[model samples]
Target chain A: MRSEELIGELTAGLRPVRRMASPARQAGLWLGLAALAVGLAVLANGLRHDLQERMLMPQEVGQWLASVLAGVLAAVAAAMLARPDRSWRWVLLPVPALIGWFGSLGWGCLADLARLGPMAGQIGTSWGCLRFILAMGVPLAAVLFWLLRHAGPVRPMPVLLLGGLASAALCSAGLSLFHHLDAAVMVLLWHGGAMLLLVLAGALLGRPLVMRRQA
Target chain B: MSRTEGEWEAWMAAAQAGDAAAYDRLLRAALPLLRAVARRRIVNPAEAEDAVQDALLTIHTLRHSYEPARPIRPWMVAICERRAIDRLRRQGRRGGRETPIDDFGETLAAPGANKGEERVAAAELRAAVAELSEPQRTALRLAKLEDLPLTEASARSGMSVGALKVATHRAMKVLRRRLGVEE
Candidate 1:
């Protein structure tokens, strides 16, 4: 089509549109809504019996903070990436937090190994963690995807990857609040694996999930 | 032309509010800049024009992503760059699979059919190339004008393959800019 004709068609079709909220603001909204949903899920499942004591432990605190930070940062990154002008470095926002999360998990695993010899990293039947992540993570992811869908991310892979990470990380953090599994290796394997799976799922669904709806 | 402070930003803000005149003004003003950026990567005029149109359409659809408070040029440039890259990739893929239906053999057999035009273009290119830096000139001569392999170019130029590639890329940019195809 000729440039003039296209410009005419576009200008003729113009309609008022609500500007997309800033990435930080949208992420904040997602964080708030996600926190509320996860909190409700935790409440329904009931908090861990030793929640107060676990909160006092350095490793436990570190793990919780790391999970929360990773989730929040990933959500922010996902939101930021919806804009074409945003730097790719925004996608790396969650790296430090993820490192902290892994460090905490490794520290716990090492402590267990020192204490329980070969029995420390036992793989148990904790399918509940997987179930929890899917149950809670899916809805959180759906909400995030819905929020970002309108913006139509230029490169959807990283946005979806970060969104998935945000959802899973938040769910895992919530899981620690309620679920009473003390096996670091089990939590790392199950929880971390669940997060990885969610991220992969999001990435695979990238193009479809964030594509702008055709008129 | 000089613009008033935040003129484009104000126009974009108005465009979001469904002001067609403001939107038209913004699009018209942005067209040349978008075209220039597209032409930087897409040498073919038709493909570059398509890239520019694609970018404008993208800007229309994703207008809501524009923040009125921010500078508009970077956002527009990024979209244009993405469209240009997409066109280049599409061209590359199609180039590998498709052949031209119109064979040039008959045309080439005709005496001096396009010779005058070709000479004019070649002279223009040479003039532009002569203004390039020494490294850039050599890189263009070896890698592009002579169509030599990078290894051969590197061997002849005493520059690393990586350096030769950079020099060639910079040379192309200079040539494009000098030829008034790109900014």
Candidate 2:
């Protein structure tokens, strides 16, 4: 009898045709882990490379502490590997927070990475090594925020792998870019690249670890 | 006296365990689910009601297949979605199958684009809903979106059951006309 009634009936009957959970969160952790392990390897290995040398600065003690922390972190990486299996966004936000904590802890090591004293300092007039150190940690912290909002479902592997590829390409370009600059600039890219890569890798790899726990 | 998360989880655990009371409560808890499911597919009020009852009966028969540990909403969703789809299919709209033409937008006579036009075609169907007569548009929208039953709509609209049926039929006809959708 009425057009309005008919409209109401049709409108009432509709249901969502889809129910699958978003796949990106899991994939994000998977890729994040791969990148994280590689980054840790780079940092731990770089620290080890620097470990044998004798001279110790008051600030250098902080770097040494960093290396020790990295060792402990590496030892327990298997235990930390449980963030990605979540089908929800809320679970994944903790990843960046964890990385940021370590970065904040490394503020001392970063603040002094540029002051090479005599010979090393002779290569440049006041290397901005600290800037690079902070730069390395900042992008990842920022990216974590991007991830909290879910930056358009980047599979964690692709994101980290892309970061790796981008960093490698940037490194070649960076060598040329930093040739006239100082070791500080190089260190900036090196650690920053590693930091960004490792966090992404952890985010990716953590997914499966989490899923294993869930299972 | 308060039902905390622990209590809810414990209730689920008990239901999981062979507690008859838990199973009954769980069944009762799903009363809303039947309404949610039935209200989606069939446009007629009485038909929607009958479909819901039949689905619940089926759920009873299939309850043994329900695993204790897995999430339950998805299980309920699967049943509801299928029952709704089935009712729609039986109403002579055919079933949800792939359309021909492969590309609706690509047929737009574009320059060198390699992608097909199927996405455009699917979108067009949704848009066509608005072009129908007022009654038909309402019926289709309510049935497909709000998931309301036909009888409930009938009461709300003050239209007789037969009149409502005609409105939906006409609405579908108009959508087919606008989109070149075949019977």
Candidate 3:
């Protein structure tokens, strides 16, 4: 259609629209819902027996805090990406927290390797962790996508990449609360692997899933 | 009249409030800016126009995302740029698989062999099929002539799907050889 004609049609169809809340506000709402979901999942799965002792260690505390922070920042980043005027730099919001997350895991891995030698690298198949993360992460991703779908994000791939990461990070943190695995290598392999899978799934499916709403 | 940045912002704010006149003015005034932004990414004039339309549609859908307090130009420009790039990518994907009508100098001839030649070919195919073994003939009839799926063909012919497939393959090969067609 001609630009002038489109203007006429759009104006004719115009309706009052309540402006969306700010990105930070949206992120907060998403995080609140996500926390509730995680809380329910933890309740069903039951908390780890060593949860109290693990909280006492500084390294464990750092990892937990970093994971939660990364999830929070990633959710904010994904929300910011929905705003057309928002700079691409919003994608970097979770980087510092992610570095901290990986750093804590690396430190733990080193400690395990020093203590257990080759036994530290003995990674077993944790189908339960995979199932847990997917169960929690997929719903969280669906909710995030629903929340941001109205924005018709211009950068859907990056938005979904961050959004998927946010969901996975939060779910992994929740997993730590219920499923006990002391070795960081095990956590990195199983939980980190699941997170990678989710991120890739989001990026691959971004154009089709998000662009459907866009069109 | 060309609108100032603040005016554009005000107009968009009004647009969100269902002010039709303000929305029309805002969209019309933004056309040239959107055009310029689209042209930066899309070299073809028609494609650039398409990008502009796409950007406008996106703007309409996401009107609520436009914060009244923020400058509108960047928001508008970003939408135009992204839409243009999206159009270019789509065009690139299509270019590989499609031949444009303009690429041809003249209209192509009518489809297929002439009527007489087609009839002769059909008769020869029928004769060849008649000469095939019973299993091959049934395979050709059920699977090829009827265009039934392998499973259905197998069920009708009382042969396994794998056997149906093999028979069909052999039948086609024999027919091709009998008709002196190339592999």
Relative to the true structure, candidate 3 has a C-alpha RMSD (angstroms) of 21.3
Interface RMSD of each: 1.6, 15.5, 1.4
DockQ of all models, two decimals each: 0.41, 0.01, 0.45
Per-model TM-score, in order, reads 0.77, 0.27, 0.74
- Model 1 lDDT tens row, A1-215: 88878999999989988888898899999999999999999999999999999888887898899999999999999998877888889988999999999988988888888876675347677888888898788778877887887445256677888999999999999999999887788889999988888878777765565785723
Model 1 bad stretches (over 4 Å): A119-121, A150-153, B1-5, B99-183
Model 2's DockQ score: 0.01
Number of the candidate with higher lDDT, 1 or 2: 1
What does candidate 1's lDDT look like per residue over B26-131, in tens digits? 9988899999999999887888999999999899988987887778988889889988998998999899787554444445556876587788888998899889
Whose lDDT is greatest here? 3
The candidate, 1 or 2, that scores higher on DockQ is 1
What lDDT score goes with residue B54 in model 2? Answer: 53
Candidate 2 versus truth, CA RMSD in Å, comes to 21.7
Worst 10 residues of 3 chain A by lDDT: A206-215
